[model samples]
Target: MENTLQLDLNRSSHSCREDFSEYVAHLQLHMALQARNLVPNLTQAADSREQLLQETQAEFEKLVSRQMR
Candidate 1:
């Protein structure tokens, strides 16, 4: 029973990682589109976008850590 529970936990972690990867891909594509559209103000756009991205990444890391636990 304990071993089966551990196996389930491992599988759930892998699935979480897979889902997280897909989510990251979608987020990156959206960011790229926003960057493209902000071409006229590329410098400010890039800065703002990078800040947003960092926040998102931090959150994602926390979420992944929780799933691993």
Candidate 2:
């Protein structure tokens, strides 16, 4: 009985370790996927902001030239 109990405990411990490791790996993969998704959105936002800035600058230059004339 004692030997059986010891074996059961060892199996439970090993199973718990495997479960924890799997959970950690799943979280890492989820975070990586989230980051992968976010990178393109962030990059697009940056590009849009840059484009807006350039358009605004061009409009401002045109206005300044019109005012000078």
Candidate 3:
């Protein structure tokens, strides 16, 4: 009887470990997808900022040229 109980406990422990491992794998996948989604949005925002800076610089140069004339 004691040996049977020990076997049951071992099985339960193994099952729990498997469950935890699966949960961790799923969490990692979810995080990777989220990061993937964020990359394009971040890239777009950076592109927009760079475009705005270029426009501002061009306007400044135009203003300086007018003042000199």
Candidate 4:
């Protein structure tokens, strides 16, 4: 009886370990997917900011040139 109980406990522990491992793998995959989705959004935002800055600088230069004239 004691040996059977020990075997059962071992099986339960192994199952728990497997479940935890699967949960961790799923979480990692979700994080990776989220990061993949975020990267493009971040890149697009950066590009937009850069373009706006360039336009603003060009406008400022034009204003300065007109003032000098």
Candidate 5:
């Protein structure tokens, strides 16, 4: 009876490990897909940010020039 219990515990542990590994694999796949979708949007946002910064910098320089004049 004791040996049977030990065998059962080992089997249960192995199954749990397998389930955890599968879950992790699925989670990673989901994250990779999500990241793939997000990359283009992130790139566009970065470009927009750069454009805004350039515009703001140009305006600031104009204001500074006016003040100096």
Candidate 6:
């Protein structure tokens, strides 16, 4: 009876390990997709923000072009 109980415990542990591995693989896949989706938008947002800053700077600097009497 003790041997049977030990065998059952071993089987349960093996199954749990397999399930954990599968869950990890799924999580990795989800994270990869999330990263892929974010990269392009993040890059584009940074570029757009830079362009806006440059345009605003040019406009503001133009105000300084006039001399104060």
Candidate 1 C-alpha error for residue 14, in Å = 0.8
User: Per TM-score, what order, best first?
Assistant: 4, 3, 5, 6, 2, 1
Question: What's each prediction's clash count?
Answer: 0, 0, 0, 0, 0, 0
| 48-67 per-residue lDDT for model 4 (tens digits) | 77667556655654654454
Residue pairs in candidate 2 whose N, alpha carbon or C atoms collide under 3 angstroms: none
lDDT of 3: 0.63
Any idea how many clashes model 1 has? 0
Candidate 6: lDDT of 43?
Answer: 27
TM-score of each: 0.52, 0.55, 0.57, 0.57, 0.57, 0.56
lDDT assessment of candidate 2: 0.63
Give one digit per residue, the lDDT tens place, for model 5 in 1-69.
Answer: 999999999999999998997777666656555644543332233577766755665565465445433
Better of 1 and 2 by TM-score: 2
Assess the local accuracy of residue 18 in candidate 6 as a C-alpha lDDT between 0 and 100: 86
Error of 1 at 49 (Å): 21
> Which regions of candidate 5 deviate over 4 angstroms?
41-69
Q: Write one digit per residue (lDDT tens) for candidate 1, span 24-67.
A: 76776666556546534223335777767666655755655554
Encode model 2's per-residue lDDT on 1-69: one tens digit a residue: 999999999999999998997777666656555644543332233577766755665565465445433
In angstroms, the error of model 3 at 55 is 30
* lDDT per residue (tens digit) for residues 7-55 in model 3: 9999999999989977776666565556445433322335777667556
Return the lDDT, model 4, position 48.
Answer: 70
Candidate 4: stretches off by over 4 Å: 41-69
Q: Stretches of candidate 2 above 4 Å error?
A: 41-69
